[model samples]
Every structure is written in structure tokens, then in C-alpha cells.
Target: MAQQERGNRSRRSILEAAARVFDERGYDAASTNEILASTGLTRGALYHHFPSKEAIASALVAAQSEALVVPDQPVKLQAVIDLTLEFARRLQHDPVLRASVRLAVEQTSFSRPAQTPYEQSNATILDLLRQAREQGEVLPGVDLQEATSTIVGAFTGLQVMSQVYSNRQDLPDRVCALWRFLLPGLATPGMLARLRTAPLPQTAPQAAPQTAP
Candidate 1:
């Protein structure tokens, strides 16, 4: 058990190091040596953990994609918005993510073939959109494929925009605003109303029935 824990720790260190190195050096320019040096691990250790630099990059991409989805959220448009806002907070805090975005922006031709990590991320997001449709959360007239692609594409564009102005703190807020605009038209009226006009919980407990005293 202890050995397994150590292995996991080592793997995380490598990924974090890769994020930093890749962010600083861009894909073609980034060196395995730099990644290894950043983590203070031996070359052999890195090789054991990841077969190649592309492998590390792919893993990092997968991690970032997974991070985009907030856990335990329902399948409504508002839920997706809430989850994405939370994820944006994470990107704001993590330098690695910031760096990755920079790399993605600069490397306009970094497309992986089919069955790549990015494709997997797309598939997962599409599945969620499909689920929302199945649950009758989206409007009846919405085209499932087009809506999914558009929403994902919008978020991707937002991410790039956020990277451009990352020095400012309002990126996430702006992205949320975009979602608010999109949700009303895309969601069923019930879902839209639930998100827009949902009442806040009355935190102050009502006093127990007052006795005549």
C-alpha cells in the first residue's frame, strides 16, 4: 500500500512538472530533460512513468479535460454552467493550466488523429449533452449534434479568450455571462426558469411554533 501511494505521488509529480515545462517551452521546444529537471527525477524514472514526451502531453491534456467537469452536478444547463464556473476557478489558480492554454493557443496545428486524448474529451462532453437531451432538459427543437458541438466550441473559444486576458480577473465571469445568454434559448422553459429564478434557501430557521407565552 505504501509503495502504491509513493508511485501515485511520483506520477503526479511528473504530470505537474510536465505541465510547467510544456507551458514554458511549447510542445516542439519543450524538452524531456527540462520536465525531468523540474521534477528532480531521473530520466529513467520519467521513462518508467511515461514512455515518451507525447505520452506526457497526452496525459496532461486528459487531466485538464477531466478537470473541466465538476463532480456531482445534475444534468441541467445550469448545472453545467455552475460546474464550468468552478472549473474556471481551478484554471485561474493553477499555473500549469494557464501554461497549457498558452501552448494550445500558439500551437494552432496540434491536432491529434482519431482516438486521441482530445477526441476522448469531446466524446465525453457529447455524451453529457446527449444525456441532457434524453432527460428533456434541452428545448424540443434543439438539434442534439449541433447544440453539443456549438456549446463545446463556445467553451473552447472562451478558454482561448480567457488565456488572452488572463491577467484580468473577470474571464470566468464573462464566460458565465455567455452561458446565461445561451441557456435560455437552448433549455426547456422549466429548466430555464429553474436556473434563472430559483429561490435561495432561507438559511435562518423559522422559529418553532410559538406557544402562547
Candidate 2:
């Protein structure tokens, strides 16, 4: 049991180190040597856990995907808002999430396209929209599929621009602005009036940390 615990710690250390390096240098430009240097782990140890650099990148993506927390709210549309706002706030501080976004948007020769993360996000939003429509929170004639795609695409674009311009320091504000523009088209007038576009209180529940593999 002690040996298994140590192994898990070692693997998490490697992943955190890799995530920092990838966040700073991107996947292709980031070297395995740099990751090794960051972790102070011998090549054998890293290889034992993650056969290659691509493996590390894939793990980071999967980790970020699993970290997303969608709240269970009586108002389903508000749950969607809470999810996006919390994610934007986390993006400013979480190195693993930053690396995941970079990996998803900037594909390299070694990495395949990042479809899984986007697909998962789209599916989650679609599900929320379906529930919202059923509850009459959504505006009439709002196509859930198109709304799902638009929200995901716009959020992605906003984050990319925020990264370039403000290093994501303004992501929460940007996301709030995004929802203000988008909600009118998606939510019923009464629902829209009740929704808050500003960042939720910092006391809002956050995503739980993922367990080490």
C-alpha cells in the first residue's frame, strides 16, 4: 500500500511538472528534458508512468476534462452560468487547465486534434439546454444544437483572446460579458431578468481536484 501511494505521488508530480512546462512552452516546443528537470525524476521513472511526452499531454487533457464541475441547481440555466463562470475563474490559476486549453487550441505534429474535451463540453451544455427548454427557461424557437455550438465556440474564442490580451486575468469579466450578449437569445425574458451576468460570489462552489492516477 505504501509503495502504491508513493507511485501515485510520483505520477502526479510528473503530470504537474509537465503541465507547467506545456503551459509555458506549448507541446511541440516543450522538451521531455525540461519536464524531467522540473520533476527531478529520472527518465526511467517518467517512462514508467507516461511512456512519452504525448502521453503526458493526453493525461493533462483528460485531467482537465474530468475536473469540470456542473452544479445541480433548480434553475438549470443558472447551473450552466455557474459552470462557465467557475471555469473562467479557474483558468486564471490552474496550470493543468491552462495547458489543456493550449493543447486543445494549438495542435502539434505529435498531438492529435483535441476533440474529446470540446465534445464533452458541448454535450454537457446541450444536456443543460435540453433541461432548460423543458422547463420553459429557454426562449421560444431557440435551437439547442445551434445554441450549444455557439456557446462553446464563443467561449473558446473569448478565452483565446483573453489569453493573448490579458493572460486570462480578465476571463471572468469577459465571460460575464459573453453571457450578457448570449442570454437574451437563449433565455426567456423572465429567466433573463433573474440571471446574473456578473461573476458569481467567490464563495460559489469550485471544482474538486482530480485524484492522482
| Number of the top-ranking candidate, with lDDT as the measure | 2
Please provide, for model 1 over 8-109, each residue's C-alpha lDDT reduced to its tens digit, 9 standing for 90 to 100: 777878877777777666778888888888787788888988999877765665565556554455755655666566556666656555554555544544
Stretches of model 2 off by over 4 angstroms after superposition: 108-114, 203-212
Clashes of 1: 0
Q: How far is 188's C-alpha from truth in model 2 (Å)?
A: 0.6
Candidate 2 lDDT, 1-213, residue by residue in tens: 699988998898988898888877867799999999988889999999999998888887776566568887889899888889978877876777777777877763255674556888988889999999999999999889999999888998999999999999888999999999999889999999898788867753555354346
Task: Tell me the whole-model lDDT of each prediction, alpha carbons only.
Answer: 0.65, 0.83
Q: Write out the backbone clash pairs for model 2.
A: none
Candidate 2 lands at a TM-score of 0.90
lDDT of residue 167 for candidate 2: 91
Per-model TM values vs. the true structure = 0.77, 0.90
State the TM-score for model 1.
Answer: 0.77
Model 1 deviation from the true structure expressed as Cα RMSD, one decimal place: 10.2
